[model samples]
Target: MKQGIHPEYHPVVFMDSQTGYKFLSGSTKTSQETVEWEDGNTYPLIRVEITSDSHPFYTGRQKFTQADGRIDRFNKKYGIKDENAAE
Candidate 1:
């Protein structure tokens, strides 16, 4: 509730450089670039390296890796033999 002490919060456009996806939102971040939005008005353009649009997790391209020799060790320790596993 203070005057002249808060950063300017206004409509800004976040652009994903990788996928060329743009979304409009309110932010206090300042940018040297500007883009004309759908309303034919210019707003601050912030170029981001990765957004949810292009991220692996959001795009379902995420990879999960199991530690080398860990699964075998666990199976041996717990005596959990795979039914189809070879001796």
Candidate 2:
């Protein structure tokens, strides 16, 4: 709580580059670019590649790999045969 020891916290706009989605939040980061928000006020613009708006997990477009067990995967990779597997 020391004075003049903390960075300035101000409202900033984070934009998802891929989806063109914008959201306003507070951040200590600064940028040379600016954007006018819905409230008709300009805020510093920060561009990011991925955000919850366009991420595969958030959008439910994520792909899952095969559900192979550890032993099965190891056997397949190096062609190892399990004696118990034959029984």
Candidate 3:
């Protein structure tokens, strides 16, 4: 609760370049680019590469490479069987 020393906290739109998702939120971020919103009014739009809409984690596209089952392949290729393996 100060005077004019505080920065401007305004509504800004975040546009996801990957999924074309638009989100409205308050930000101190500045942008020289502007775009017309659904209200027929223009607002500052921030273009980002990825967002939750297209993120791999959110979309469940995360992949964990096992290197073609290296452990199993190695055991099979070398005839090295572990006693812990169940039949």
Candidate 4:
């Protein structure tokens, strides 16, 4: 609750670079770039590489890696045999 100590918060447009998706939200960050929003207002434009719109997890395009354990992976890589397999 101090005065003259907080950064200015205002509407800013975050744009997903890959998909060209734009959304307006309040932020303390500022930029020299500006963009016209859908609400007929101009706000600071911030370019980001990834957002929910283009992220693999949100878009359901994520690739699942192998579930092999560390020991199993190391043995396979160095062609080592598992002694426990003979028991």
Candidate 3 matches the true fold with a TM-score of 0.64
Q: Encode model 4's per-residue lDDT on 1-87: one tens digit a residue.
A: 999999989999999999999999999989999999988999999999999999998999987797989999999999999988866
Candidate 3 stretches with Cα past 4 Å from truth are: 1-5, 66-87
Better of 2 and 4 by lDDT: 2
Off by over 4 Å in 4: 83-87
Go through the candidates in order and give each one's C-alpha lDDT: 0.93, 0.95, 0.88, 0.94
**Clash totals for all candidate models:** 0, 0, 0, 0
- For model 1, residues 1-87, the per-residue Cα lDDT tens digits are 989999988999999999999999999998999999999999999999999999998999987785548888888889988889777
Candidate 1 Cα errors over 4 Å, as ranges: 64-87
Best-matching candidate per TM-score: 4
Q: Weakest 10 consecutive residues, lDDT, candidate 4?
A: 78-87
Q: Rank the candidates by TM-score, best first.
A: 4, 2, 1, 3
Cα-based lDDT at residue 59, candidate 1? 99
List the candidates' TM-scores in order: 0.68, 0.77, 0.64, 0.81
Q: Model 2, residue 7: displacement in angstroms?
A: 0.8
Please give the ranking of all candidate structures by lDDT, highest first, separated by commas. 2, 4, 1, 3
Residue 39 accuracy (lDDT) in model 2: 97
Put down candidate 3 lDDT per residue, 1-87, tens digits, no spaces: 889998989878999998899988789888999988888878899898999998988999987777658788999899998899789
lDDT of 2 by residue, 11-80 (tens): 9999999999999999999999999999999999999999999999899998778798988999999998
